[model samples]
Target: MMHNVSHVRFFFLSGFNETVNFKVALFSLTFMSYCVVVLVNVALIVIIILDKNMHEPMYILLCTFCMNGLYGTTSFYPKMLWDLLSPIHVISYSECIVQALVMYSFACCDLSILSVMAYDRYVAICRPLKYHSIMSKQRVLLLACFSWLTPFSISAINIILTSRLKLCSPYIDRLFCMNWVIVKLACFPTETIVNNIVSYVTIIIYLFHGLFIVWSYMYVIKTCVNSLENRAKFMQTCVPHLTSLLIFLITALFSVFNTLFGSTLPPTIQNVIAIELLIISPMMNPLVYGFKLTLIRNRILGGITLQMK
Candidate 1:
């Protein structure tokens, strides 16, 4: 029962750590991760964009994953960096609210992109001959557009409803900017409404996405069993996608566990899992995909060498 308030705002207590040394280390690590995450994803996008040889649907979906990585880092890096550098870490009420929404949106985009990638693999493996006709350039473009648009629409709805509420204090409990934390901190009666909307969004994104992934793998398994020639390629494709999904699912599970079990796990452990699932997963995607797929890596290296030459 959150009230529709326009003029109300909140104060965020960002200076949580008393030790200066901790802040310095946090800043250093954040700086390094931000650089690496951006570089790797940008490299992936550039490789796919420049290499006409790699203009297949799989690479196109990989490009979307790279974009999702950028969006994911953007949602938190700015504030985290700000908090690390300044002696007193602080964020405005509106800023926190917007960050919350952006966090969810980025998250939504990430899961959606991964789901699309899995589907791409399914098409590539299960329907090899029809892959080209089915996943034509136009269709790939349409799918990419839908991936972006779907998340943006859902994010907009969640944020619009979220922004309508009045937050008492912006002192969110959890680390690294989360919607749940901010929403929980907001002293509003209609917080339930916000949570309910979030609940609905979560169900829609994760449930359907998870179901599609399971279905894709099911078909993938069937294809694997029937085909002997391209078994290695098909299995390789499934590995990274499944690895990424499992890592993501584990993180989601922990968060749900912490919330439901009320076990009072240390916030540090929770943050570590969050960082692993967010920063670590995106950074690893390029390597995971590249190492597992010979063609992708070769194309990337060839693209780099060609540039240098």
Candidate 2:
């Protein structure tokens, strides 16, 4: 009889190895953060769904964005909370891959959704006469689906390629499973050429997303410069979107650059950078949108007051 064994069936996450002394504190903070993330995101999602006035393209896109934030954070925080409680910090191979998929898809989809939001704002501010026709509910739904499905498909391809490699090590130095980190574990460096190509391509694709956002904002800024009404609209609406985008890109690029170059930093700092996107974006998106967009804010206040009554 012949036996076929897996090369690596699990990965040991070393991100928290040195920080175990603060496990209780870390768990407390993470759990509280996770609760806030869920509550805020879900609240926004529900408010958008229930309010007919907010059924516009911008709010709908914001709703999808929050949903994606929730999706991504759920993938990390639960397992992370568990690992924080456990002495052994390990993840099964399949679970790791799925986590990587969820994370990448969530992030890429976020950029995609943001791009759509940028377009929505551009149309509203720049081409108001055609905004309704261009961003109809059907069109909005299509764009939202495209934003989500395209990233998921891209991430699935990357994970599929990763699954075929024969891993040289079972240890991951980070707090969670990232696709690039998994690629680095391949037994032979030559085997990862395709993965690298795919990753760069993915990066370039999202880089264009960033460019779209920049170009959109440039035109928006230029348009708002001369008109007081446009300026008020910009401050009232577009600022939140831009803030979310800024936070997202900064945290995401920090992680990517740190992973590729920040070898000299302590593991604690690296861990902080690695999880910054998950921590900051999920919490910030809803708060920014919830407070900045008045309709949703009033709806929430109304709901709370009714509850109090």
Candidate 3:
């Protein structure tokens, strides 16, 4: 079979074919959801920035986490909303690669940020005296930059490798572009060997990130178990982090499973799974933190009450 690597400029997203009958409804819902996501995340970010009392390391991490959610969701929602209303669903190859980069980086950065948060909790509970010195503003800023730059560099490498493949098909079966899906379109399996290696290596690197988070929490829990004050601290600060981690892991696992076994499921179900991370994690993280953390909760409530006055 002859492959036309040079001429493949755009990829057709066939996932929209099933939505023609309800495009308008889908468009409205997607647009509104995107708006809500933006509003909530931005609200949290603003609250944290304006209130100097909330400028501590933990709150700074939370703000970065919300900003990441916004970054991840923005890459998908706008494209999706437009595709929902358009008759033809297509994305240029370059645009698809960029989307995949941003989406994957966003996810990887989420885990990295969570790892940093766990460390912050660990230091706060385990070594309270050194918490300030350890997580100083400069150190937190460095960790935050690491959380973002590391994942983006990794995802950029993946996208670059993916772009080198000679694609046999231009039709992507899903609603959005994904690195693995694009790699599967390669004309020859032998060419994807390097891609596969790098992909697994990336997975292992993040898997260790997951293990690190688990270890930090375990240590924190063990320490908190022996002390009443530590337990209270755990309840107030660590609980929200744990909730966010749980939400991220669930959505991430769904996405992975959908990628591996999705063809066996109905299209609608597959679509839902594909989008679960984008919708649920981004929207729920801020809500969980806003309500669970007393300081943030009081701040939000105080503002609401002032408006009522």
Candidate 4:
């Protein structure tokens, strides 16, 4: 028996099973949401780029974060919209792997960027004198590249490893292609040892990112407690980053848990939780930064007021 035989050519996505009756309504809502996401993120990016005043490292990082949100959402929204409208939800094997890669990398990059942002805040708050020297433009650019490239490389490797496996099934219970879900379809469990090891290493690495964030903020909060100036700085800057981090973690964790133990829930509820990260995080991040960050909020409002005139 050729254990490596891969007969699967397509994957059936059943995440939309419950939405058949309301597909049209869901499509409309999703379409509007996508548009809003694009508009806000692009608006923020343009504001940061055009206004030389907003070219500082922190704002630049925020722009990078918003751009990442756009990248991640772009991978999911179009396919999701198509799935919502189509009677049959199917994705080609190659495309499914690519989509899974993009989705996973996008998420991992988000955490990487957030981790960098946390460090940036830690430096700006804790080591105020050296913030500029430490987070220079060249360095920020390098950090941004690291955030994007590292995760993309990791995800690509995972996808490549997954491609070698012979899948026993072609159905993905969730709406989108996930690496883990695809791995679950492997014909033989023994083929997955490398995949599992790599996945665990990846998780540990990103988990360090989460821990770094917690530690960074602990010092930040403690530092702020002693000084009125630092407290105001923390409120002014750290809050938005904290909010974005909180939103990302909540959505990502829900999806992760859903993937792990969602069988007990109704399919509709499971699907919603599974996709909340892709939908809510993209839309919410821009809104959170646009409203919470004073400079960004002012720039956005100023742009609106100018266009009104």
- Best model number under TM-score: 3
- Residue-level lDDT of model 2, residues 1-309, one tens digit each, is 112223898999998797789999999999999999999999999999988999999999999999999999999999999999999999999999999999889889989999999999999999989999999999999999999999999999998888888887999999899998898888888878899899999999999998998999899999999999999999999999989989988998898889778789988888898898999999999999989899988998999999999
Query: What is the Cα-based TM-score of model 4?
Result: 0.97
Q: Which residue pairs show backbone clashes in model 3?
A: none
The per-residue C-alpha lDDT of model 2 at residue 236 equals 96
lDDT of 4 by residue, 89-196 (tens): 999999999999998999999999999999999999999999999999999999999999999999999999998999988888888898999999998999999999
Error of 3 at 80 (Å): 0.7
TM-score of 2: 0.96
Q: Model 3 over residues 1-309: C-alpha lDDT tens digits?
A: 245242578999998887889888889989888988998899999999999999999999999999999999999999999899888999999999899999889999999999999999999999999999999999999999999999999999998888888988999988999999899999889999999999999999999999999999999999999899999999999999999999999999999999889999998888888888999999999999999999899999999999999
Residue-level lDDT for 70 in candidate 4: 92
RMSD of each: 2.8, 2.0, 1.9, 1.5
TM-score of each: 0.88, 0.96, 0.97, 0.97
Residue 88, candidate 3: C-alpha displacement in angstroms: 0.6
Structure candidate 4, residue pairs in collision: none
Model 1 spans with C-alpha error above 4 angstroms: 1-3, 6-10, 13-15, 18-20, 188-191, 259-263, 302-309
Q: What is candidate 3's CA lDDT for residue 92?
A: 97
Question: Each candidate: how many clashes?
Answer: 2, 0, 0, 0
Between 1 and 2, whose lDDT is larger? 2
Ranking by TM-score: 3, 4, 2, 1
| Candidate models: Cα lDDT each | 0.73, 0.91, 0.92, 0.91
**Which residue pairs in candidate 1 collide?**
1-190, 2-190
